[model samples]
Target: MTLIDALIQYGLFMAKTLTLVLAIGLLLIVVLRARPGGSGDDDDDGSRLEVVDLNGRYANMADTIKAATLPPKMVKKAFKAERKAEKARAKAEAADKRRLFVIDFHGDLMASEVGALREVISALLIAATPEDEVLLRLDNAGGAVHEHGLAASQLLRLRSAGIPLTIAVDKVAASGGYLMACVANRLLAAPFAVVGSIGVLAEMPNFHRLLQEKGVDFELHTAGEHKRTLTLFGENTDEGRAKLREQLEETHAQFKAFIAAYRPTLDLSKVATGEYWHGEQALSLGLVDAVQTSDDYLLAARAEADLYKVRYRARKRLLQRLLGADGARALARPLARPIGSVARWLRNLGGARCA
Candidate 1:
């Protein structure tokens, strides 16, 4: 080949090689970003614990509005004077002032956030003193017994450690939610918030008759007689129905006992009837200590104590972040199909054991 032609060919080869290299580098970057703890510096458990100074945020909001309303010339002088006053107060009371840590729990049917709650509690158990107070802004309408039971036990850890626990329910804290609330030293709720569904219930549909009409047979084998009580496909006898009721009663008794242990003064018999009430009525029923929103309580508490909002956020896996939680689960359904039936059965069974 001529020198000019050879040079051109070499240049083309170099360009292709550079393009391939760039593509591989970009792929590497994407994969690294998708890894656990890749988005930021997270804990060994692929989580991040954040504590925000709510007092500073509240002060900033007030200062911003105050500055906007004041004349430009006076704005500087007013802020300066406020800063001086704040510095003097901090110096005088910093040593004696107690801290109030706040956290939030927005519950669902599974009480799925309990894992993050455990991490937050673990951190507080080490950092918080008896003088420090904890406020849980809880909004849960209740869920599975075992899941909420675990969540409530995490709160009990604070009480056990001598740290005062206060629960503020601005919306709803019914059934399993109440199970956790009753454990608090003080429970506050919004005026119209729903509360108190201190009861247990289990229900499922039986399709044995439908299968029999279609000339289809479904068989289930269990080692124990009560192991398969209230089957979905198999025929259910009066004995099986009675056994399920007996089990539900047993769970209900345990639930009532748990509340009584934490809140000795509550009249469980009056409230534990599978019914819910609004916040004002809940207070009358002795289910909540006071009818007040979380915001008001935090605002009032900010004046006396330094308030901080603590949160534990688990890093989402790559698929979760890419497709969202539900979509990721859907994508994995085929791989999990082997145990899908059993998982659904257990999930339905758990639905019956709500607080």
Candidate 2:
């Protein structure tokens, strides 16, 4: 073969090999991402709960900045004055000093952070006293009913222990997120945070029409009449749609009831309309107790209480440590598109006849 033709052949071979490798790699990444405790907990080898002194951290930050701008004499004077004040405050409050335990739950659509939250809550249940309080820095836009429901139930454990649970939302606590937030004894939200989407949603795309046009046969079998409703592959009927709607309505009612049980003073009729409101509006509607960000709350608490941020950390595998979950997803998208294109090209090339 001519050099040009040989080069083309070699390029095609490399392309095929690369496509196969990427396809396998993408599959492995998906499996790893889906595995439970991908964030470090499920692994048997390396996991621990991390407790950080927020009070000390805040002081250090202030001191560092003060030292940067102030002259050496003023810096020393400031440090000495702060030390005197700290000793006096520590002496007076030594007998009744309260602890504020902070936990962060940055949830995804699956409420996967629930695992780490579980560890934190368990630790608090053992160590926290009735005088102490929990401030959950929660940021979630809502997600699966069952997942967020479990997360809510976990928060309820603290309330059951009379530990005074408080949840602070800086960005959003809607739908399933609201479900978890309502479990708190006091819920705080930032002025622009989204809150209160007390509604149920169920939806799926049906491909029966496309299959019919392509002369493809699809069959579904179920023993019970309501076993499957509003499916993805099969044709949907009015009866199935109606049943799904009924289920959604039932879930919405339960959600409202759950919120009412926690915040008995809320007017469910006005706020449970499947619409979210900003934090200020939520405060007016009684969806949140106050319009304050978590940072503000923590800063204020730092004056009278010792603040500690608790977290669960697990040792990560080499691959997990390198790419992490988000990185793996970012890598997967580029890999998946090229794999599909290469697959189609290979199929088309194979179909072409030679003379």
Candidate 3:
């Protein structure tokens, strides 16, 4: 070995060692200083209502007033006075004007988006009046039953409060998503938007056959006969299968009853066939009220009234921002459980599927 080569190797080794030591020190400091999740001054105030101004109504109002003709200085004075008076009148009118608040829901199978939904609705219930409207832009394929039921219940709060709630679906609202949408006083969907699939489903794989073939026996014990209707590892019997079907049917009935109660005029027999339809087809079938895109509705509403978006905007933690997503998730994975609770709550709740 050459002397120069050995010296170079030693320097490189020392540099690498120092770099790793510094990294470990930084991580330790971050861990020590880290705050618990959703525990910040901003967390409490994270959610807020923002005014959406797609049109320049507020900005162009001053230039829109008609000024009276007069001599040079008098004309300027009259124009200024007119503008001032107009501003006061506009302000007064706005105070009395009916408001329309907006909230958005982009969901998945687990209906994970319900947590934020509840937060946003709580704020709306405080500010919205009978005359004021709440628009929810929803998109979801659907998921778990009880989870989605809770989500639908959250939207029902607005209905009970006498706030006119409308749901706009640009893409899809099937199964549990429809459960949440059906609570709306009126549903507006884009022409190509997917809707319906009023149904219930559930399924789980069994490894009983694999175990039996391997000469391994599986035994499951439950206090109640129906406590465990199906098993993942144990053998599934016809009785267990029948009991599972019964439970799914009952849940489906509950879903149908809830929807029918809210939308009494709908023909449950024809519409609840577990079949999906495009918005255009759905309108005639009583699945949706109007075939209109959210873009058009919001654009029109913007020109007519003040459009405000109500939301709970949470801020990222200091460590999260500093270390980035991977680091935060890695560190948080163990300390924070129910880790994906909000993510699941954020997903659109869709109806169950059986296989």
Give me the candidate number with maximum lDDT. Answer: 1
All-Cα superposition RMSD per candidate: 11.9, 8.7, 9.0
How would the candidate models be sorted by lDDT, starting from the highest? 1, 2, 3
Local distance difference test, candidate 1 = 0.87
| Residue lDDT tens for model 2, 136-220 | 9988887677788889999999999999999999998888889999999999999999998788775445789999999998999
Of models 2 and 3, which has the larger TM-score? 2
Residue 209 in candidate 3, Cα distance off native in Å: 0.8
Off by over 4 Å in 2: 1-23, 26-44, 321-355
- Each prediction's whole-model lDDT (CA): 0.87, 0.84, 0.78
Worst 10 residues of 2 by lDDT: 346-355
- TM-score result, candidate 3: 0.73
Sequence-dependent TM-score of model 2? 0.83
Question: What lDDT is reached at residue 19 by model 2?
Answer: 87
**TM-scores for every predicted model:** 0.82, 0.83, 0.73
lDDT score of residue 312 within candidate 2 = 92
Model 2 clash count equals: 0
Candidate 1 TM-score to native: 0.82
